[model samples]
Target: MSPTPEPGLPARVRVHEVGPRDGLQNEKALLPFDVKAEFIHRLAAAGLTTIEATSFVHPKWVPQLADAERLFPLLRDLDGVRLPVLVPNERGLDRALALGAREVAVFASVTESFARANLNRTVDESLAMFTPVIARALDAEVPVRGYLSMCFGDPWEGEVPVDRVVRVARRLIDLGCAELSLGDTIGVATPGQVTALLTALNGAGIPTERLAVHFHDTYGQALANTLTALRHGVTTVDASAGGLGGCPFAKSATGNLATEDLLWMLEGLGIETGVDLDRLTGTSLWLAAHLGRPSPSRTVSALSPKES
Candidate 1:
């Protein structure tokens, strides 16, 4: 038999930090607006190029994001950084646009069960609703990112089919979305599953380079799964600082993978995240102390220096 080619080098991955928005939103105490701005400032200082700042979801739905109108302008005009927010519908997009939001993300769920619960709309209905939102953004020369939740497993449904995931990804790409972020809303994906999904997405001519992984560390497998995704030539993994965030409608724990942890693994693997571990970990520790709990990331906790 002919010799197989050596395992080629993996592509460089970009970690978009989402901690300031996703990380702090779920906290019961609800961080003050100033603290939220500071959190974002610290993340940018830590060298994160992209950060999902906040969502324009109604205050009744997610009270933590009530300050979106105020926070967006404060963070949007920062020099040399991209801050995108989650806009649920046309109304939300209107708010974001009025705030001069150039980049925004539209979120939907892969499974019908997740869609109904998260957005109170069916899969097709949600897509139909987002069509105008996407169209308007494109017309305005704005960049739009699509988010697909429960690409792996859902709390209500045991496991989602691979075909379903592929279809949703294709739809999002076809909707003029420049990028798609696959979300593990329940945090149940294994390394094998991560590889399989990315492989399928790559095979479908869906441009894996434009893909981003939004993992939840519910089972503590977020970092390991990230390694698998990186190996499969998938870049732009999303992470929240202090391992913060959880889905409101989703049943299981769905906190995001910690930025500090993701950076630790990437650096150890000789991957360039351009994020400073000490500064990030320092911020993580500082935030945790404010929240009055230890962080969930093993890497962050392991490399965490003594608090002075």
Candidate 2:
């Protein structure tokens, strides 16, 4: 079934598949290194070009990804895929660099509470911590991606002002980040808020091309918010397979926008994502079986065979 095109939207969208890292980080079942590596390989086989392979955060912080060292080596043979790892600080960056990571991302929060809660530092202090990390990564010829969480609303601090988000976003851009991913960490953003924030960022001299949207489905607005972002010229989107992970720090947050769910909409809209929906769905189902549970994705549920 060919999709009818929508005017004024991007012809192609880059799906930043975060299932391996963001999706699995919060899972209670600790998968082995081989299973994790195979999951990534299957995702790439499904045509996801850029996959966030894993995080280099301390084992004490995120024990699920404690095997970053062992897991990354197995993926060194994967060709034509961008496996960007998450680095929490200088030590995380060093671990990624030691393993020949071509790209890395640093996470940040726009609110003081989340910054202190997640990074154990004030907003300014966290940025200061990332300053050298971003610089060092750039010096090593590795592009840095900055993730700005709580762009719309926060559980600790409600109603994040657009101007405040813009200020922090600019600081990240100035810090030499190649791209910035605006995260709706708690999934409280509406279409109107999405428009306002993107407009404010554009007005503040941040090009739409340099920005990406990461929405959570807590309010069931992740897809709508994502579409609004696409209308506003944001081509890069972050989604997790099977709608799997949430912010471990923010209890109110739900799973991220599912890759299968997002792919359905993009395919229906005639927007090119280059992802094989069937293969991706199969991968999600496979992972779900391993976790001894069913997937949370609506699209996956609808497409999956019914039980007798």
Candidate 3:
């Protein structure tokens, strides 16, 4: 067996906050549009430059974010913030464009099962679906993000092939996506898997600078996987405040890597993220109170007083 090759880590990382879109999507109790808007504002004020605001999917698909149009307008005046919304298709893109979204994201799955379950299409079909969406966004001078879910493991297929992930990722980049976010949807990835995946992607000519990692903490490896990504030169990571949301299609998928938890590790390593840990923790606490549940973030739990 060969030891994993360590790449030089970046001096700073960009944490993409996905709480408003991805996090709230899986919640049963749909928050009001004002609540969601306030949440995004709080996240931005806490120094999250890249916050995924809302998804332009049909209301039938994700009722929690059905107020996307209304919600986006409320945060239009937020300064120095990049609010990217998820667009599932051309119609979704149309909705986002109507809302004057400057950035948007499209999602696909690396595995066939997840692709079908999540997108109701095959892998190739899903990519083809996003082709026009990506093109139109780029034509409109809007930056588009590509989300490749089930990169490491799939709920039905178990461990996914690294080659498949790389192939899908390359296609995404070729389709005009400005950046790609690799997701550990079920959180079954270990550090070794993370390194191997990134190495394979790098070998396929996908630079780390154009990639982001999205990890779920189901198997308690989100932080470790993130560390491995950092060491492999990936500077962008996807996290949710309060560790909210899971995959509705993937039954085993759990909460995403918490922003507070990721921030703690980065700050401890003296890595800059321009995010305030205390303020982030408070934001999580406020969100937890709204959700009427304790945060799943270990850092938030550890930092809060008994009374809190």
TM-score of every model?
A: 0.94, 0.99, 0.96
lDDT of 1 at 35: 79
> What is the C-alpha local distance difference test score of each model?
0.84, 0.96, 0.91
- Stretches of candidate 2 off by over 4 Å are none
Which 10-residue window of candidate 2 scores lowest in summed lDDT? 1-10
lDDT of 2 by residue, 1-308 (tens): 68988999999999999999999999999999999999999999999999999999999989999999999999988899999999999999999999999999999999999998899999999999999999999999999999999999999889999999999999999999999999999999999999999999999999999999999999899999999999999999999999999989898989999999999999999999999999999999999999889999999999998889
lDDT of candidate 1 over 14-59, digit per residue (tens): 7888887777778877777877888888888888889888999999
Alpha-carbon RMSD of each model: 4.1, 0.7, 3.8
Query: Which pairs clash in model 3?
Result: none
The number of clashing residue pairs in model 2 is 0
Report the candidate with higher lDDT, 2 versus 3: 2
Question: What's model 2's lDDT at 191?
Answer: 99
Give the per-residue lDDT of model 3 (tens digit) for 1-308.
12233446677899999999999999988888998888888898899999999999999988998999889999988988999999999999999999899999999999999988889999999999999999999999999999999998887888999999999999999998889999999999999999998898889988888999999999899999999889888999999998999987888989999999998888777788999888888888988888888999999999887863
Give the Cα RMSD of candidate 1.
4.1
